[model samples]
Target: MKYIKEFEKKMNLGSDNQLANGHVEQASIPKENEGSVQTYVQLLKPERFYMFLEILIYCIVGHFIGYLIAPILKNYFYNNLEWY
Candidate 1:
């Protein structure tokens, strides 16, 4: 029990130290102006374009699947219809 408490105390201290260091580093960084076009361009990485292409391909595939399945679903539902 004592050993577990000590271990937890050490872990807590380590996390606090890390948090303090992060705050210091964050304070040291210069604030970027929000209106900078250069910063905006830099933020638009090539990975974003690749992600967009991936999403677009998935959307097109989904549309094609839905189109192919629609007729089958419609026929099944129509055939299974019961008189009210």
Candidate 2:
């Protein structure tokens, strides 16, 4: 458990550094004030896209696991426990 926690801490720090670097790089790039669409496009860097993908995958996997486990838990509680 301690090793898992340590690994998670290091991964969080690495991601933080990646995000800080992305922000710094984004700030260094100049954008035109022509329209909101163009500005939004400028903000969509590749690293941000991958980060978004990672979040999407995590969400999908988490929901799938929850869906798979829900019925078993429901059945167990329905048969083995009583609620008032």
Query: For this target, which candidate reaches the highest lDDT against the unseen true structure?
Result: 2
RMSD (CA, Å), each prediction: 9.0, 12.6
Tens digits of per-residue lDDT for model 1 on 2-81?
A: 77557657656334323422222221212565676665665565777999999999999999999999999999999999
lDDT of 2 by residue, 1-84 (tens): 677557657656334224522343223233466555666576567888899999999999999999999999999999999888
Q: lDDT value for candidate 1?
A: 0.66
What clash count does candidate 2 reach?
A: 0
Worst lDDT window (10 residues) for model 1?
21-30
How high is the CA lDDT of each candidate model? 0.66, 0.68
Displacement of the residue 12 alpha carbon in candidate 2, Å: 29
